[model samples]
Target chain A: MNPVRTTLVWAVLVVAIAVPIAAAAVSPLLAWRSPAYIAAGFAGIIAMALLLVQPLLIGGYLPGLPAPRGRRIHRVIGAVLVIAVAIHVAGLWITSPPDVIDALLFASPTPFSDWGVIAMWAVTGAAVLAAFRRRFRMRVRTWRHAHTSLAAIVVVCSVVHALLIEGTMETLSKVALCTLVVLAAIKVGVDLRVWAVRR
Target chain B: MSVDLFTRRTLLVAGGAIAATWGGGLHVPAQAQGLAPTPSMRGGSNNYIPNAPIVERIGGGGFWMTGTVRRAGDGAPLAGQRIQIWAHTTEGYESDPHSHGATLTDENGEFRLEMPQIVPAFGQPHGHLAYDSDGFETVFLRPVMPSSKDTSLRADFVLRPV
Candidate 1:
């Protein structure tokens, strides 16, 4: 990908990731700290990882000139994202093992926790599905369609998870993340519109 | 009329007795207490051990002190806290080992303190603390300093990775 596209991707990722973090940073001012903050932090981390995965799905959809290069970069970023997500989850585990376990196992008492867990499962499923797309004999267009739909679901669910949560990034981060979600939607919309016009 | 009256009286008394028994069973005593079957205070997991020990903040800027931490007042390792050690370098874009590093201080302060794990050239390190190739390397937290002193504990740390 060119610098512009790379920059845009990073921009979106930063906004998606940083907004929640910013919210977390101001958590003390809000005077709210509970299982909610831990939930929010984990959601942010997972969303950040998903942002890194976005370019991979993009590369998968858009073919031609240096496709292999994009795929390579995607793998590298995916690896890094895994480490980051692990760190995020690990921090939570150390902080509150019971709640973390609850979230992971779909037993968390809070409703928003379910959203996060669902997003995690969806993202994991998408990754696995993409890995075995060929084995399932999924046509390129069909697979791309499924991938795009799943990606949207992941992003949307993650955003909802973050919004419902109050943590270090209580307000501004949610607003910022919500804005990025809107921008990402616009980008996807434009891409679809262009594709439709061409069709 | 007499038989009917006697039968009604007996039925009423039986019903009243049942109702009284039910109420007695449902009622809580005047000395009702909170919690139940009090488990041993020393046992089970209701104890909050203060996981604050897991977050270790080290190697950063702003009158920061670099040191090592161990358990108790001994040279034992303290682990499981979020240990973030950070410091800064004078040169911009230059690497500093003390910039920002994190580790879970083990039960003993035998933490294998790695320098700030930055993306090097890719991502911008957020905090102002710097960790470059030069300057104070490897932090081994000795228990000599108390928590009241430099929070980092200023324990002796060697340059080698253990």
Candidate 2:
């Protein structure tokens, strides 16, 4: 890609991710919320934004940043994503244990909890599988297939989870980000075709 | 004539009893259902708990707190405003930390939150709301519900800038 086009692509991606976080910071809700809740809320926004990046990075969809460099950033983002989930749950736990317990136990009346928990487990499972691939005696092709399946689950469930929520996020920006994430996820799935790892 | 008068008085007493028994079914004025002359209370939220759990909904989600938050003078809808609500309910008292939760307004400056049916306490069924965001001068409200059977209550706030 030409330098101008490359810069445009990167800039659009950054702004798409940053807009939601920026909206939350100026939210009057921030004044009423506890520190833990605010931290958790922002962490969730960051994690969702990072979701859009992960697929693009791994699939080499980014213009300037190619696979090798993108992959390194992807690894660091994975760690951050995990920490974000931990903080999200922890903040919720502090505020109300029974509610979080119901969500974890799959008994919460809310549908959003189920989606979030499913996405969360899928992400965690993929991370663990990656960490212990050698011990599990998994070949490269097998690991790739397994990881790809989990990635697909994470993207779909996370999108539903975010869309179902009626919280502090501005609706227009939230929908835009979600739509972009879904399109990006689909692009990677079709382009990379990680399922056909049998070379 | 005396027998006819006695019969008329007996019927009147019976009709009065039935009306009293089913008062809620009567055509009570809709305008009479809310707190009369609701004003910002003096030290109303002295019982407000810090960090009282910001949540999307509270308890079993049967009752709702919904209203518009707007600027005081301009009456412009204030999107993204925060309103913290609590009441004595099946779960706990208004002062109980568990009973408290906060929610943010949407793009149109409207806010709604689900909570358990508020039970009457100290002879009044009421819900406490506070415009406790820093950008506005604090305004607290204690709105009286006309009946405990009410599933929803509305409390519109016009907050003055701090």
Number of the top lDDT candidate: 2
Q: What is the lDDT of every predicted structure here?
A: 0.46, 0.77
Local error of candidate 1 at residue A66 (angstroms): 9.1
Show where candidate 1 strays beyond 4 Å: A1-43, A49-72, A193-199, B1-162
Give DockQ: model 2. 0.03
What are the per-residue Cα lDDT tens digits for candidate 1 across B68-108? 44322222333443444432122222223334445543565
The CAPRI category of model 2 is incorrect
Model 2 / residue A130 / CA error / Å: 2.0
Clashes of each: 58, 0
Query: Which candidate comes out best when scored by TM-score?
Result: 2
Query: What's the CA error at residue A135 for candidate 2, in Å?
Result: 2.8
Error of 2 at B45 (Å): 23
Chain B structural similarity as TM-score, candidate 2: 0.73
